[model samples]
Target: MAERPVTDRGEVGGASAAHASRGDAARRLWARPAIAVAAIYIAARLVTTVFVAVGAAISNSRTGGAETIGSLLMRWDGQWYWVVGVEGYPSELPLDAAGNVTQNAWAFLPVYPAITRAVSFLFAGQYPIAAIAVAVVAGYGASLALYHLLRERIDRSAALWAVAFFAAGPLAALFQMGYAESLFLLWLHLALLVLVRRRFGWLYLLIPLMGYTRPGILAFALLLALYGICRWFRRRVDPLPAVQIVHIVLLGLLAAAVGFSWPLIAGVVTGDPSAYMETELSWRRGWTGDHGGFVPFEGFIQASAIWFRVWGMPEAWGYVALGILVVALIALLVFEPHVRRLGVEIRLWSAIYLIYLLLVFFPQSSIFRLLMPLSPLYGALALPRSRAWRIGVLAVGLLGQWWWIDQMLVQGTTFWQIP
Candidate 1:
């Protein structure tokens, strides 16, 4: 029947060859070094999972806490997100017996909870599983983006090692939990990538989503403003069109406006324009003594004094110690050659974020999570002159990750811990 049409085998062989070529292309893409970073990320995650599971199982025997892996992953902030996912934000802010507003869903942003709620619907209402899946998947995307960013400045091997360090960092366990750190980090890295590429228009879109995710949107806006100013100066020498200058100014203002919108929304919902800042200060009302005022950064100094005195140190010395630590960390972050390697925009972001943390946030055990944006320093750790040193740093980081999980989640301790 096919005498007129060549044998069907010939057509079949052509189709097979086409399929083979496509397969080869996929293989080539997978072989890329950045993809290897993702592979390393998966391996580190598996190791952490095994450790957390074992820790939980052992702890369950003694404490009868939620030893199941799923339960353990749903600790701390994850619980708040779950509440928001199942029950939307409360119509009224909760008040304590003393009449002060208590912890409410408004304290947490809606982005992570909204995503978890959507995923839970797809899973037939397995909210915990849905949240964990979102975090894990987002963590992978973040690792890949990190590798690409590092690769822009360092070699392939170093980039891989850097990603490994980031995945095994002290608070890396947060990535495995049903928390929004991974989601926030994914957006953070993506925004940085756009900024590094000088894609300002993308930020006009990204700042709004970031505003929904965290109140730290203003930090990024400040970073972009400073960067734009520098670029504007450079362009003055070379010169650009009046329209171009106007576009840049308008975009900068718009980004900052969008960045502050979330706080304004929170204020509106609570029936007080200053509700956002007032609510943040409410957490510090639990301090031990006449520690300090309600002003920004005062909580940090006050807490330092209380923490050291609890350990039997004199309060005055404790204040001195806190002063030294702040100065040293600021010096290190500002002067570190590694920080310098990140280029002007990223450096600006880091500097602004640090200042924002100092001025607005309090000192807490959860400071590690607050500092998660600095994970790029892991790339510097990957660049020691000796290979053994790099391996040592990564090994220590993984060990710290395991220790953090064991202490924070497995032990089920509630004595002023931030888990």
Candidate 2:
């Protein structure tokens, strides 16, 4: 058109330069994997924070009590952790009128509370603040570790998507809670990362950390055993060295020892040979009504019957459903193409950990939280390249997060609502 003014041309040039600078900054931010993962983690945490705040607000309004976010974070099992941190495990177990062991600190491991106690000193000994801080920081570390772990087996885009799914999943609220799950997950993800990289030496340190942090080190031990067998079978192609063999054997033994050490420590301290086992069984009694001694693979079976009866179904149906679930899981691990792509080590770890849970864990409201360790499976779900599919799953996760927070944290007045 008309002749453009020189001043207008200069203004348009300046605007274009600014826009280009902003675009370059955006590209640079996404280029660093760590920074990008951190951004996703932080965004997820913010959404979880909103959920927690809403839960607390709703809880307080209903109860007419002072239910702040910190207090809500420290609810349920969080209180047990606080007890462990403040009072330490009792030398003599608490007993009911029937002389059965009641729920006590021995049911929880020491590392999480120990670290929380140390961190609390920085905040004038506020356990909730310390606990949440530890959980949030550990969760951030776990997200980074998970991304790196996935990157070992997948493309960068898939790895990042996996991390996003993990961070924003239904149990995302755990990442900011006063519970031990997030810290344990950080150790677990790091252990898995080293395992995938074939850096067996690092497991020397990680195994002990995992053993102390949670009750799943036995599963890691089993993973090492299976991994060793796999390596031996493939030695011709993979070139399994003698040093790696030693590392695998010793690590497996170390994990087993540490896995059983907690029970021994509890036994020695409380002067009861089955102190830890009894303490765990104490929780199961609430549902099963004073069960017998601990037996492998019994809890799930017992819980299934109890749950089925409660659901107005025949108890036999629970066994049938449980069998079907076991078969479906096995089929997925053995045949699912996406899961196979996650590599053998991940599959081994998942299988072993699920076995561990089926062996000891009583199915209850807490089962969802216990399943957090299997989160690497999110990689499989992230493998599909459809953006709409990914976004749909993410939306479901966010909705699930809200529902879990509302039921388990906000309207947690009933026994079944426990988180």
User: What lDDT score goes with residue 86 in model 2?
Assistant: 95
TM per candidate comes to: 0.86, 0.96
Model 2 alpha-carbon drift over 4 Å, by segment? 1-11
* Residue pairs whose backbone atoms clash in candidate 2: none
Stretches of candidate 1 off by over 4 Å are: 1-30, 233-248, 288-294
Provide the clashing-pair count of each candidate structure: 0, 0
lDDT for 34 (candidate 1): 61
The 10-residue segment of model 1 with minimum total lDDT is: 285-294
lDDT, residue 251, candidate 2: 94
Q: Write candidate 1's Cα lDDT for 93-173 as tens digits.
A: 666686665566676788888998898888898999899888988888888888877777777777778888888777777
Residues 1-419, candidate 2, lDDT per residue (tens digit)?
35567778889999999999999999999988889999999999999988889888888788898888887778899999999999998999999998989988998999999999999999999989999999999999999999999888888888888888899999999988889999999999999999999888888998898899888999999999999999999999999999999999999999999999999999999999999999999888888786589889889888887789889988777688788999999999999999999999899999988999999888888888899999999999999999998898888989999998998888877767788
Give lDDT: candidate 2, residue 267: 96
